[model samples]
Target: MAVTIFLLIVAAGAILFIYQTFLRDKWIRQKPFPAQHEAILSCNLPIYPALGEDQQHRLKQLILLFLTRKQFYGCAGLEITDEIRITIAGQACLLLLNKGWQTYPKLLSVLVYPSAFRAERDQMQDNGTVAIARHDLLGESWSNGKVILSWDDVEKGVSDFGDGHNVVLHEFAHQLDGLSGSTNGAPPLRSNSYQSWARVFTENFEDLRHRSQRGLATVMDQYGTTNPAEFFAVATEAFFEQPWQLQKARPELFAELQAYYRLDPREWQRSTEND
Candidate 1:
C-alpha cells in the first residue's frame, strides 16, 4: 500500500507539470485574437509585412497571448485605447516570435505616459557622495514585472522603423536579460551556446566601450556602452531595425543574436528590399 501510494503521488505531480507547461499554453493558443487587432498590426508595424505566412501566424498567436496576459495602464491622465494596447503588444510580441511562444512571464503591467517622463534617481558622485537626480527617460523596465514607456517615443519607433532606436524593444530586451535572475546583459542561454554567447558578448561589449572612449563612429549606438544590460537592449534595437547594417558591421555579434533569436531579420530585409 505504501509503494502504491508513492507511485500515485508521482503520477499526480507529473500530470500537474504537464498541464501547467503544455496544456495551458495549448489552451491559450486556441483562443482567437480579435480581427481588429490584425488591422492595427498591419498598419503600424512595418516588420509585419516582412514575415512569412507561418511566421505571421505565429506572431499573431504571440500577440494574442501577450494582450490577454498583460495589462496596460495610461498614465499622466492619458486614456488607454485599443490602438495603444495593440501597437505595444504587437512590437513586444515580435521579440518572442522565434524565441518562444511563451509570453513574458515576468511582465504583468505596462505603464505609458503621453511623452518623455522624468524619473528621480539616486546617483553616486565621484567623491563617494550620494545625490538625488531627475532624468528624462523614454522607457524603463523593472525586475518586478512592470514596464514604463513614453507613448510618443513608442509611436515614433514604429513609424520610423529604420532608425535603430526602438524604445519598446530596448526596454523589453532588458526584461529578457533579467530572466537569468539578473540583468547583466546576458539572458538565459541554451547550455550548448552559453560559452560562445559569453565570449562574443564580452568582446563586442569591450570593443564598443573602446570605440566610445576614442570617439569613433560606431554602427551600434554609443548608449550601448553604458553597461552589458544596455548593450543587449541597444543591440536588440539594431538587430530588428537596422538588420543589414548590423549584420555587415558586426557579423559575429549578429550571428550570436541570430542564434539566440532563431530568426534572420537580415534575410527578411533582403527579401523586402525591392518593396
Candidate 2:
C-alpha cells in the first residue's frame, strides 16, 4: 500500500511539472499577442520590421514565453510597465529566435534600475587587505538566476541597434555562455563545431587585445579586450548590430557566430537597406 502511494505521488509531481512547462506553453501559444505589445516592439526594436513573417511570429512567441516565465522587478523608483517588459523581451528573444532555447532557462528574475547603478564588490588590495570598491554598471548578468540592467542603457541599446553597444545583447550573450556550465567565451555548439569556434574566437580575441593595447580604433569594441567572455559578448553585439562591418573585417569570426546563431544579420540588413 505504501509503495503504491509513493508511486502515485511521483506520478502526480511529474504531471504537474509537465502541465506547468509544456501544457502552459501550448496554452500561451494559442493566446493572441496584444496589439499594444506589438506596437511597442515595432517602435522600440527596429530589427522587428526586418524580420521575416515566420521569424516575427516566432519572436513574438518567444517573447511571450519569456514574459510568462521570468519575473521583472523595478528598482530606483522605476515602475515596471508593459513597454519596459516587451521592449526588453523583444531584444533578448531576438538572440534566441533561431537558437534552441526560447527563454533563458537559468534566469528567474530581471532587476531593472532607472539608470546606471553603483555596485559594490570586495577587492584584494596589493597589501593583501580586502577593500570595498564601488563601480557604476549599466548591465550585468549573474549565474545565480538573475540579470540586472539599467533602463536608460536598455533604451539606448534598443533604439540604436546598429551602434554595436547593446547591453541586452551583451549580457544575454553571457547567459548563453553560462548555459554550457562555463561562463567562458564559448557557448554550446552543434555537432563538434567547438574546435572551429574556439580557434576562430581565440585568434580574434588575441587580435582585439593587441589592437586595443595600441589604442587602435577598430570595429570590435575596446571593452572586449577585458577578457574572453567579454570578447564573446561584444562580438555578439557587433554580429547583430553592425553585421556588415564585422563580416567585412572578420569573416571567420562572423561565420562562427552565423553558424552558431543560425541566422544571417547581414542578409537581413541588406534587405532592409534595399527597402
Best candidate according to lDDT? 2
Residue 4's lDDT within candidate 2 is 100
Worst 10-residue lDDT window, candidate 2: 96-105
Candidate 1 lDDT at 170 equals 96
lDDT (Cα, tens digit) per residue for candidate 2, span 152-265: 999999878898999999999999999899899988787689889989999999999888889887898999989889999999999999999999999999999999999999
lDDT (Cα) of model 1: 0.90
What is candidate 1's lDDT per residue for 1-275, written digit by digit as tens?
Answer: 99999999999999999779777677777887778888899889987887899988898888878877899999999999999998998888888988877788999999999999999999999999999999999999999999999999999999998789999999999999999999998899888988998899999999999999999988899999999999999999999999888888888999999988888887667767868
Candidate 2 segments whose C-alpha is farther than 4 A from its true place: 1-16
Report per-prediction Cα RMSD to one decimal.
2.3, 2.0
Best by TM-score: 2
Q: Model 2 misses residue 257 by how many Å? A: 0.7
**Number of residue pairs clashing in candidate 1, backbone atoms closer than 3 angstroms, sequence gap of 3 or more or interchain:** 0
Clashing pairs in 2: none
